[model samples]
Target: MYGNQWSTDGVVVARNGPSLVSYRFILKRSDDGKLFKCEAFDSEGESILESSVILEVFYIPKISFSPKQTLTVKENEQAQLICINDGNDQNATTIWKRQRTSTIVQNNCVLNFKNVKRTDAGLYTCIVDTKVGVYEDNARVIVLYAPTIDIEYFPSTKTMKCIPRGIPDSYMFKDWEHTTEYNDHLRFLATTKEGNNATLTIPQNVNKKDNNRERGIYICRASNNISSIDGTFAMQKYNLNLPGKPHFVSSTENTQYGIYLETTEIKIKFVSVPENTNYVVYKNGIKFTDYNESVLRNTKIIDTMYGKNVSVKGNILSLFVKLYTSEDFCWYKIAVKNVVGCSNYSIKLFSASLPGIPQILRAVPKQTEIAVLWNPGFHGGYHRWFIIEYRKVGDIYWSNQTTNSPNSTVIGGLQPVTIYLIRMFSRNRIHDSKRTEEILIQTGNVLMQ
Candidate 1:
């Protein structure tokens, strides 16, 4: 029979012989044949015929591989491998080696690759052979760099877009800055999808803070699990203003029965007018009703039609010639006469003749009775009167009559066999003038006795 005891600190001994037995423990070294005492154990009780002993202790060092965490090196760069061993033993020597390389780098334990290619990537290990034992550890080394960008201009929105070179899982976008003073609250936006591409939009309406402001440079950094790249673009500015000049197209007059003769249809062509202004039309001295609406609210196309009346607000100053059926007539002395305190602007009707004598013109059939109508000039004065006079082709003494109203009378007119001259003059207290021209009448004997 044998007796055995074990301790919590990894020591065990057994006794069956008359003498006590003790055991020495050591860890094996890999690089060189060496051993160090890891633990020791001795039998405490008396031993009889046989005895056994066991001592267990582990020898481990603080070992680490070079380029500890992560690295970003350009392609074809010269990189170095450094192995470090932080343990209690100073006689320990480290061996630097890679999973793919068979040549073991010893002594200084520093591995240098003059030009590292992507194929030279692997798990680098550092093995330390010490007098006590062997220890080792490893780290993963990576080779990668940032990306470049190509930019193009989008004219429609006055924006610039940046395109990155490679596939990226995520991206970061930032506004460019010329100096250290930065306004981080730049109004910009960026969006991306899984496969296609990314885009950034700058709103059309920017606040006063961003008005007339240069679109600063923008940086786009794209990242995948293995690598990252960056691209940049310059800012752009947009202009917002109104359009220019206007032109006239065409005009017209209407002769529909019973419609006021001077009330005509006018067609005009022109450019778009800006909002908020008033447009008024005038015929002779009378205000026509072409445009009672505000110009700003009207969206009429250029070269459109409009209509208006000849007399507005009861003012009788006809400057425009009225086109009649199968005939064209020009009348003068179309003087707009007004009495005192009338406060109206008058269009001088020149007699179409001498020393400026006041006169009215008529185009009628010879020997036929004709009626003349005119608006009484703006009514304010004490006396409103018109004088009607006519002379035969060769007669010098004028047959004349006076009337208080704009309407007058003619009697015993001849047949369609003679040409007569008719004239009307308007008079007021302030001044007197002759008509613009004489009315021409040629009579025809169709129904005459």
Candidate 2:
């Protein structure tokens, strides 16, 4: 076993015979696939023989995959993959590929996705090179998104859809219902699913309650394992029919109790009368449907209920009738018969005639007060005075003053640099006329007559 010398430094060389030599060294990852050489020289210091050998070192490349082997990401978010090699190789490169493509997308260790899209979902393979050999790994990416909703209406049905466009096509839905812009709940007729979409069907022949409820807000809810959302709309009818009904009440004294015996033309005013509408008058359970020119020509019959005439302008309907004391004790009603249907009867007892509204000429403002001038419109055959109402602009309450004169009056105790709204009307023994047209005025520095 005797070589000339058995020694170990960076490597160990042993010699036993004249022409026998051996070289040995510990194998390491850094020494893998390295070349080694030994040389022999003669006694004269001249090279005689030389030999060379290749060193083989073995090691497992520490392969690691980032973002795990399985992962999920939201739509429009960032995603990434990293392949790391912790082996003994100074020059190493990582290649990223999608699906089974052979092209290397990235040369660095990390694969960055600043903004991921729906088509970015798939398996990613990363190839890492090391001193030992080339290694590879895979990571799966998932993208989730909310459902998109759309609606369509037909002559006999309405269809609502909730469609999915993300990686996973699974979706759930809530029924249509009445909801605000914020909240969404499930409660409608029927729901069906096909492929990656959900649909809600509403038949036109639904119940009357449901039919009426359809005019309001309708909400549909769609959700998945990732997110929940809703869509809404307000249903309305474009074509409308049926005019609103009329309203009436007894006014001041003469008409307050009943029709006056001395009255000739009874002027009855009703509200809520739409424009261009024709109406029928009823007196003592008799319908006055005739618009005969001859009956209108006869002034004597015109003085009676048989000669009743109707006129509608804007929101007011005026009916002029002549009544006798015997017929005065009966009830009066009106019906708007033709367009769609007649409303219920609005009944009233004719006791007496009331005073009419006064016409306001003008309101003049002084330094600290105002002078209001007006003429009685139609007093309904009663003596009356003037009642003036005044208030500051934008004030909720009002102040009133009474004067015996029907023509004009002066109001004092006012302030300069102030604005006031004033209105005046005439009043008799029992009731007052509708207030006159409102007037606005500002006080000045000088008082006027």
Candidate 3:
């Protein structure tokens, strides 16, 4: 009886009851399949005829949130968000916005992030708007980046935890190690890296052999199995140690084995144990305390060493040594001393000498010129060659000529029957040898006589 009438209601007058009846109700998308009916009853109210209409409703569009409520990706990697929508409104505009800001990020059902970054992490809202109504939903975008491992010391708990800045959920703790000397002397420490925790408890209850085990540098690391950048695997240095003695450290390839005079210099760089280290240089077997000048020659001494120059930038002792004479080449040394102990180093230098004199083999005289053949003597640990000097027998002025080979040279533009004194010698970059014993020769008219 509630508004299911046909053609009339109470059958009074046009204004009150004789008006035709109709069914009227608010329609919505949910009411699209609802049925409405009208009935006409007989005079005795025994039989009735009914008419019905199934409602068809049209409404605005509504979008469904993507299945991935939260997403994670590495920096510079591609990522996207999809919003599935269902509605009858044809021109529905979908907009994606960062919930923290009023700016719209995307203008479609799919929100695309071609290159995701750490800053893109936050709640993103997808809004679908029709002319009649608007529908919106939110999803979280979690951008995963390279795991940055940082060591956090907890004094209260007496432990240090390796915390990853990026998505820790995806990263696993590798291990904790003592990197005091890097990998060569590396010792893996006991850590709480069983599950997701990366922590190290300073060893307290240990035997004598494990004394100061917690000293030196400590490192904790984590990784997400993906290495896209250099910082993907982090290695931090923490200096935790007791005082140590000074020592020398050598690099992989060092050319300071032997020192040769006038041509080379040596530089040694190294890091010693922390604290004030006193270095004393030695010459031969004597302590090189002050500068000493060699009147015979000038020699300079410079201090240099090599070791793990890390941790502390050890005190530098630079000595520049320039020795001009062969006698200046000798044993040099470095003495490193601290409160703990002393260390010493020594090096020997060899000197190069002038070449030896050359010997004349034979002489051939022409009408106005003469040629001399000679053999070069030992180089005496230096690069050298032969040279010839000659002059007229009675003249004091001498003429010199360089040998084409170590064994030959020529002297021309001479008088035909004149006597000449000739000699041969050797010369190096540093010095020249004494001339050999002089010999006399004569130039003749017909071929040399």
Candidate 4:
């Protein structure tokens, strides 16, 4: 056995007796290339036998993470990770792959991602491979990204919602905005939220006054600590033609009649509230044919309740009638309708120049007086009165009686036993119309003696 004077560095030798020897040492990675020697000699210290041994140690690669802590990465950016080779064997090959799975990563110990996505976040393992065995450990990566937004419109609820998805499972609505075709911009203060989505409710009706705030696009903005994003929420348009009534504009009639033939033409102009739809025309309360006129194809704008502007057009209806008789006047009406409701405008086709003659004249004679009754006709667009004329038979002058009552009149102070002739006519502000047929009457004597 060698003596302790020749050995140190965690090495010990002992000789319990001349026939027994023992050696001990604690092996380490630094001792892989170190040499240990033992010699036996006579009592005079002559070299008898010598032997040496070289100690080689291989470690199981006590593995640890490169970052020693969790790694955090932003979405849609480049990322890379490394595994430090702290093993004594520098010739060992390095490998990287996903943890708890067989998905191996390329580029040896370094894990690389060009534009890492949200789905790429999870645990990754770094494996150090050597002839002895394989050593591995796990590391975590946290991917933080901006919010993603999607907008949905619900016609039944008259509402719009903005849905957002982001990392950290939290987000906020940044803006509620609007954009018009005319390049106008508007902002809304949105203070309401339900669950994880932001909602904007639409007004069922618009108050019409002007055309300043009409059809446009609605936008929703969502944001997180990383970034902000936007999406279209709704497109607003006004359809005043539904769930409302049509309006009356104006009406006109042109009439011409000879002794036999009469021709009447009517023109009625109307509009729908928020108007633009199919309409119907009526002649004497009966449905007439469609007369889709191109001359009145014009529209105007209306102010909405939310201060939006939209267009509504006026409609024109024309009806022409001809008959072989002179009394062929008519009543014309226009009706515009839709699924919401219906409305009408009407016109009485008649001339306003001269008042109509009285008809169905009746006379009741008494001893010294007479009474006349008649039915009235059209007023010719003016206030009218009836004139009754009476005279003795073969008399030159006729006495006149005026009555505003359309039904009857009375004449007193007539001579007894006298024959009389009478007639009636109607007069307006313009002039008198043609008189009715004459009637002959005889007054009775006093007491009929």
Going through the candidates in order, what is the number of backbone clashes in each?
38, 13, 19, 10
Off by over 4 Å in 2: 1-18, 22-62, 129-134, 149-161, 165-172, 177-199, 203-219, 225-449
TM-score of each: 0.24, 0.41, 0.48, 0.50
- Ordered from best to worst TM-score, the candidate numbers read 4, 3, 2, 1
- lDDT of model 2, residue 197: 61
lDDT of 2 by residue, 56-167 (tens): 5556677776766766787667877777767656776678888788877687888887887667778888787766688887878776665555444342445555454434
RMSD after Cα superposition, model 4: 24.6
> Residue 371 CA error for candidate 2 (Å)?
22
CA lDDT of 73 in candidate 1?
52
Could you give candidate 4's per-residue lDDT for residues 321-368 as a string of tens digits? 554443445556767775445767666655546888888468988898
Candidate with the greatest TM-score versus the true structure: 4
TM-score of structure candidate 1: 0.24
lDDT accuracy of residue 206 in candidate 4: 61
lDDT for residue 340 in candidate 1, whole number 0-100: 13
Global CA lDDT of candidate 2, please?
A: 0.56
Tens digits of per-residue lDDT, candidate 3, 1-449, equal: 22226322323211111224654546778776666555654556533566666755657665666657777667788887898778766677889999968998888888888878788988999888876678888888877666666677775555787776666466666557664433323467777864555778876533422222344567776777656455556555566544445544443113232234443443444444444346777777887654432121111212222222323233434455666556557777877676766666665655556778888889999988888887787776545777788899879888888754777767888888888999878887667899999999988877554
Give Cα-based local distance difference scores for all models: 0.42, 0.56, 0.64, 0.64
Q: TM-score: which is higher, 1 or 4?
A: 4
